[model samples]
Target: MTTEPQRLQYLEAMGLTAWTARYRMPNARPTEACEWELPVPDDGARQAPGERLHALLDAPAEPSVPAPAAPAAEPRERPPAGERKARALLGGLVPEAASEEAAPGAAPEPARSVESDEPREALRFALQVACLDGRWLVVQPGQAAPSPLAQRLLANLLRAAGVTPEHPPAFEAFHWPQIEGLDVQAPLDEARQGLGAFLAGRARRGWAPERLLVFGDEATLARVLAIDDGRSTALDLPAWQGPALETLAGSAEAKRDLWPRLLDWRREWHGEAKGEAKGDA
Candidate 1:
């Protein structure tokens, strides 16, 4: 259990403000401390952003996990709908790249209805990477194109990393099967299995990145790293063979807070790469 002060501190660090329920007993003085309790979902594995953050704050901190031996590729079928919910939550938080289509006066596609049975939940998340050699990989979220804001942010990050915008980089991306809606939660067992399978497939294809720059709430990190502990700027996971850094997801305010830190990290990474080259020489 988390104390009020500690809970408030965690919320503050995550850039969130907590408030009491709209309805309250008459003549009763509302206490902010008492309202700190977050509503938990029925499924223990699938948690709302607030509950996930609390879990992270409450868990004992552990050292980064060591990188494990490379696993051989194996045939595995993708998990079913409910199984993908936990990962979907993280996917929904991260925006992917948008392809620039020059179709002359093509009508805009309609947004998918949340109530529709179509598995659009899987389409809402994406992973993108921009390399220095003018190459980029944009794992597109569902059927939707990346938002303009997401595109700009990715371009900016790549430019800051020394990639020229004009030349751009090789770009590749894929969409996952649509699940239910983003709001649905999956059971813990199913969520873990889905995440494991997804990561395993990516690893087998040599798609593991040295570091993942995650942009979203604390829950996004929890889902990606499969850990429920205190939040940190950096997390090392042997499963991905790298460390991941957390940042504000897609918001103007996040841009202000994240860019400086991202640039600094890029500089350090470049310096380390150069040092390794010099040592080898």
Candidate 2:
């Protein structure tokens, strides 16, 4: 059998805002890297101001400031309640994307949940860092439109990437608006840059994906590894002819030893009425 990595625990970050990245090792506990920085935005509503300062900066003194309009899409939704818990050392594998939407306020639905019969007996825990392209997709089940991040990191990523709306549900962020089409949520456009940096930092901390895909933009690839010194670099992943949008990582076989056990006290959080809920999914 192959030996696991000696060290784990990594974070993907950039300037002001960043997310955490966790790594698992065979026969050992999983760990993660510290957080990083990405810039903050001035205002959530001020995102995607289509005029450059150069034009307005040189324009007549009496410029017309247009009124802000409601977002050009459906309203936001409420997030489902409850997060999963886990314990245990792992066998050095990752998990697949379990994309089932939980009803609003329902019992916890797992992206992946681990429970075992022993203490600290779970094999691993999971982190759901959702993103809508460069934007951080903040969506729930019962909501309307999403709120934009009032942060610079997100804005720069959008501005730097030349973000645009492809379809109502599709917004793109990139350097060349014509070429780099990143479909993201409108509210998240502001924080795109920072999120990219966050994903990059996560990669350094052993959160790298064995299989990577790029949908919307290269940030999908960044989900696996950070954007390095090279732009025209090779994507690190297995050979799959499927769609490029879903960059997958890890294997179920490597996660054999995850200890799956709920806390003695928290088990009752669901209560016995969850018998039917437990049987589903």
Model 1 whole-model lDDT (C-alpha atoms): 0.42
Candidate 2: where is the Cα deviation over 4 Å?
1-198, 204-206, 214-233, 239-281
Over 236-281, each residue of candidate 1 has an lDDT whose tens digit, in order, gives: 4322111222222334565565555654455444555755644643
Per-candidate TM vs. native? 0.32, 0.15
Give the per-residue lDDT of model 2 (tens digit) for 8-55. 111112312333566655788656787754444565444233344334
Model 2 is weakest, by summed lDDT over 10 consecutive residues, at 1-10
lDDT over C-alpha atoms for residue 179 of model 2: 15
